[model samples]
Target: MAHHRTFDLLSRLPKVDLHLHLDGSVKPETLLELALHQGIDLPVYDREGLIPHMRVGEECGSLIEYLSKFHFTTRIMQSGEALERIAYEVVQQSAEHNCKYVEVRFAPQLHRNNGLTVEETIHHVVEGMKRGQRDFGVRGGVIAICMRNHSCQSNLEVIEAAAQFVGKGVVAVDLAGDEAAYPPEFFREVFAESTRLGIPVTIHAGEAAGAVNVYEAVTNLGAVRIGHGVRLKENRSILEMVKERRIPLEMCPISNIQTKAVSSWEAYPIREYLEQGLLVTINTDNPSVSGTDITNEYRVLSDRFGFTAPELVKLIMNGVDAAFLDEADKLLLRREMENEISSLGVSL
Candidate 1:
């Protein structure tokens, strides 16, 4: 049996985060500052007053309610400077937590209401992420989001913008937004274009909907990864298929509990899925929105599910395996992680 590891050791462990949202992870203080700087209106002017409206955990009623917070965040993230700052802050935070590599994602179209084109949004975001990499020495990548609730025409623009930055820094494309109302079928053609452009795909599914949505995302949209796939455990056949295919599931415990996707941390299927030999990678779907971070996420898995140091190592390895990085980069990351662990007197 595996024994639990101390939080201090976990904190020192090198990590990979593949499913963080930029719009959802902006710091409260930063949000307030941006609102004032951008001349954007906000119901609250200070961090203490704004945190309640921004951080939604168990109080979050549903996915829609959790997502509603984006309205305030997106308002401040419209300009190039705002986007750059948020991107830099996200990577900086990840670096502080010992995350060696991270993939930050957001829908470019959401920022276009302020007169920025989708391309401009992607450019600024990539620039910011690059700046963070230089400053923190923590490598980062961008994943342009194609919102499901938006029209195919709108998603097409996002896909085109993503294609323009494939090797530059945009590593992959993803589908996000209301999962139940807008199925993967709606974005099939857009994902196809992304595939043709050699961009890997991940889709938000099985969170607000059923396992069939997960199936559709994999079969129709070519999603190599699934976000918030908490519901996939409900169907054994689908679970078995996912296991057989080695499809990685980006499971966010606190976010799921806050969104009411799962009842609580104890009820989350993370341990069960791991026991069943599924490739489950822990993540923070929306850190600020859920009032959590990568370290807190690992702590939850340890306290709630009894994930020991070895199991935690496996979880991080799962993220490394699922990253959208190139083969050479992946190999280099693996070596670095191994060396980091050896220096800390730990082993896989």
Candidate 2:
């Protein structure tokens, strides 16, 4: 039998987070400060009082209710200064938790309500990620997300604007929002442009919907990775299609459970997927909103699923393989993770 490790050891290990959301991950104190700076009226003025409004947990009713937290967060992320600060702090926090790499994602369209263009919005996030990397030594990238509820024309404009910074700062594009309502077929033209530009693709599916959505995201939208694909097990054929394609599934344990994406903790399916030889990578979907960090995510697996050191390391490697980076960077990151573990006097 495999023995679980302590939280301290888990915290020290190098980590990779690929599905993190920028708006939902902002610090409560920072959100309050931004609210005050912008003179935006928040329901609460203090961080403590504001947390209940911004953060959520397992008791949250459904994915829709959990997503409601972003309504307040987007209000504060309207300005370039606020966006830069939030993006920088995301990587800074990643370093504090020993995350070697992360991909911070957000809908550029959501930040444009304050009169900024989509290009300007992406620029601020890229600038912040650059500064964070220079200072914290954490390598990361920005992902531009298009909302499902938005018009196809509107989403196309966002995708075209983001393509300008693909390699410069933005690494990939993603789809988010009410998956059940919009479905993957709705974004065909929007993601078609992404494919034409040779940009990597990932989509939010199988969380609030069924496995068919995941199938469409892959078969239609060219999603190289599926975010919160926790519900893909609903269809064996579609699940096998994912496996046969070698497409990785980005799983966020805390967020999935909190959103009721699964029936219960036992049905989360991380172990089940692993047993079947599917590629699974752990991520922090929305740290502050979910009230979780990458460390706590691993702790949950350790406590509930008995993921030993080797199993944990396998997940890390899976993240590396699934990253949007080129082969050279991915190889280098894998080596650094291994060397760092050795230096800590721990063997994988």
Candidate 3:
């Protein structure tokens, strides 16, 4: 059995985060400051107005409504300076949470409404991320996300932009957005292009949709990692396929509950996935919106599901193994984690 204090200490352990959204993790205070700098009036400024919108309560009826809150966030991230600042702040915050490595994803198409070219959009974010790494001493990378609802041709352009940034900090390509209407098959060509270029792919599936989406994402879209694959619980066969293939599921418990994918933390399928031998990695899809962090997510799993320290170490190892980093980097990170755990005198 894992001691509670050990679990609390594990929360402080440096781990790799494989599924965090750079835009979604914006700090509320930073958002307010950015809004003020841009002279934009946001309805929720302080913690009082922000807490209600952040928590998972009766007010958030569905995933769609919960996601609608991004409108306020996107409003302030219109300029190059704003994007750079937010990106830096995101990496800094991740480091504060003891995240040694992170691959932050964001849809460049969403930032184009403010007159920034797609290439320039990626450039600004990459610049910010590089700066964050230099200043914070936390290594980070960018995953370009194409919105699912957009046209396939538009997504190809996003992929092309990402391809151009290859070897320049853009590590992977992902498909994200409303999953209900836009099926995974719609962007097969874009994913094919990513595969052809040897770029890894992750798709948002089994969240708003069901197991069918997960199947299509793997079979048709070539998603090596499935984002928010909570709906895998709906189909046993698909879950087996995931386990057999060793495909990673980036599970976000608080985000799922906030989006009504699950009713509460106790109802989450994380333990089930772990017990079944599926490659599961914990994440905070949107820390600000979900009002949680990597530590809080780990704490919830510990308190609610009785996850032992060894089990928690397995979960962290899963993330480090499943990350998009190169072989050398992965080996270094693995050794670092092992050394830290060994120093703590916790036997696995």
Candidate 4:
């Protein structure tokens, strides 16, 4: 009964997802159906069989192994329609969970293996998200990702394609992939191009690597937010830098646990960071990949960390503040969210 009430309250709260990946959030059922429709070959023939292979187990070895799951999902997402369906479903799912805004990201270079142009890939995803917004009232934005493992030239090409959609539907540009293998310093010039065009930047850092990576992401790549920045807790200087600059850490607790990003749930740093008055936001870094959602993320925070309605409200509002929306949109969201949350017995 308590769990049900908690879920009901959580569903009623307005939310924002800052670090969702399009290719990483495809549903298992949808994956099987899409595979059949596209005539793509799969190792497993059924959803149950495919799920165990797709979703990483609780003891995922390393960040590289954790990311390899995308190979299967991205292979099937090369077609324009597949990209559209994935983006559309992402928005629909976010809306169903009461997420008022979201920033969905994907690496265009990953989808071009099947011969589709990068612009076409971005166009299809934006089209699907726009359709979802029109139907479900969930405001959506895209973030073009440049993989760390890919060639610099290819990443530059992705930047050019992403810059074209700066104000159209794409919200920001991001760097993703094996952070430990490819440092943020390598993409210095690429991120400079994004900065020159006034495009916001976010980087996947302090997850597979260390605080040095987080430092480079902000100092070199000009990142406004850090994705899965759970490791930022280890270094005091990095923590101070984040707090001083007010850089938001997009924290995905379950995903971190599954990837062994942190040793255990007891050692999670989000609550500690919050207690220190740092800017932090809760996110489902990869819903389907992590087999979790924004609501479940909140439930874990509540049940495991003893977060109350007020504390949960603060985290949700952090997402609002950290969103890639413009000032006017942010103001509108703040007012709307405040009204809704306060009515639900959340105090400010």
Model 4 ranges with Cα > 4 A deviation: none
List the pairs of residues colliding in candidate 4: none
Q: Tens-digit lDDT track for model 3 on 39-156?
A: 9887677856765554445457788887787777888888888888888988898888888888888888888877998888888888888899998877888999998778888888
Cα lDDT tens digits, model 4, 52-135, are: 767887878877788989988998998999999989999999998899998899999989878999899999999999999999
Candidate 1, 1-348: lDDT as tens digits: 223447788788999898999999999999988888878888878888998888885667999999998897898888999999999999999998999999999999999888999999999999999999999988879999998888889998999889999999998899998887888787889898888888888999999998988998898898889997899988889888889999999998889888888887767888899999989998898888888889889988888877777889999999999888889999999999989977877778
Clashing pairs in 3: none
Please list the residue runs of candidate 3 whose C-alpha ends up more than 4 Å from where it truly belongs after superposition.
1-4, 44-59
Clashes of each: 0, 0, 0, 0
Provide the overall lDDT of each model, using Cα atoms, as 2-decimal numbers: 0.89, 0.91, 0.84, 0.89
RMSD of each: 1.9, 1.7, 2.0, 1.2
Could you tell which candidate, 1 or 3, scores higher by TM-score?
1
Q: Candidate 1 has what TM-score?
A: 0.97
lDDT for model 1 comes to 0.89
Assess candidate 4 and give its TM-score to the true structure: 0.97
Candidate 2 C-alpha lDDT tens digits along 145-236: 99999988889888898899978989999999987788899889999999999889999999999999999999999999999899889899
Q: How close is candidate 2 to the true structure, as a TM-score?
A: 0.97
Candidate 4: residue 134 lDDT (0-100): 94
